[model samples]
Target: MITRRLWLSAAAAVATTLIPGPAIAAEPLEVTAPTRVLGAIVAAEGGAAVVVRIDATLGPADLRVAGAVHSVAVSQRGLLDDPRNAPRVGAGVRKILSAVRPDLAATFEANHKAWTLTFVRKVLAWNARLAASPVRGKRIVDSFDRAALLAWAGAVVDPKGQPSPPALARAPKDAAASTLESYVAYVEALVRSLE
Candidate 1:
């Protein structure tokens, strides 16, 4: 079993080589909203628990960190355009009906499934990439980069199309850092809980 500290250390080591950033030590991972949600979902024994955790943490996202979670989740379901991505029975889909937003049960279920799928895919991809690219100091890029970039993009633009000057000036940089940091934390928590 991979411990969180060891896993993060390995990841930071790899990232230091591939990513063009200062040689600063990896920041201590923060247990942000997304980290909590993913950890709860992985630790949950039943769909009801999953529904409760997701609702409590992800239901009303007021902060940029939590909102980035919503964005990452929506992207996982292909932005909810196609109905094919939604799970018909699992991922707390049925449990969410009574827990929250009964009218939008399907949407909630789709989001739940999307996040779950993304969790599984990221873990699997992490393992695969780790195994395939075992050589030290090798530069490798993957979906984690895409997710962080997308999170940055989502952070900058206001969906209402009227971003304030202050927001426009600061959101991208802050969101990019927060998104990447929170994403790594979330992934590490998931691996620790699920593995």
Candidate 2:
């Protein structure tokens, strides 16, 4: 189990040699509303806690980012979508319904099982990309450069030296990349100084 610190250090050393700037040769990753919507939900409500389904037209979302608000078009299934699995599914649904919108239950029961397997898959994809990419950015280019560039610096200059950690934990940056299937690799690393 490579700890976050060690993993970051190893990658930082190799940052300079890695591809610079946008992978122009590589296809630009698609950043869509649905993806952002899923991220917004996760960033605010927590990922896969119950796979909360939100009304698509809720308008001006409260992502819990202290002043930043986004309106994402949630592509979600109804809470009652699976009666057989309601015990598991409803737990998540109830949490969201009580906290965000109690009315969702009626809407959910009306449209239960309208679709299936949307929320969990989206959450999984986000996790995969989150773990793979080292460069973190709000937009593809921004994070791609900052994360990778910073990693290179940490690896080459700092090495065993304690230094600032990468700006990898910002909610906006993480959410932005959450649903992207691409944006894999470009690992960057840095050490945390005990300051």
Compared with the true structure, model 2 gives a TM-score of 0.22
Candidate topping TM-score: 1
| Every model's TM-score | 0.25, 0.22
What is the total number of backbone clashes in candidate 1?
A: 0
Model 2 alpha-carbon drift over 4 Å, by segment? 1-93, 96-104, 109-116, 130-164, 169-195
Pairs that collide, model 1: none
Query: Which candidate gets the maximum lDDT versus the true structure?
Result: 1
Off by over 4 Å in 1: 1-90, 93-98, 129-184, 188-195
Q: How close is candidate 1 to the true structure, as a TM-score?
A: 0.25
lDDT of 2 by residue, 1-195 (tens): 999999899898788568485643322112122234243323223322223233333342223221234433222222111122323432443344334444344543333333234444443454444444333321222222233333322223233333334343321222224321211111111111100
lDDT of each: 0.34, 0.32
5-79 per-residue lDDT for model 1 (tens digits): 999999999998898976554332222233332333322212222222222344322112212332223344111
Prediction 1 global C-alpha lDDT: 0.34
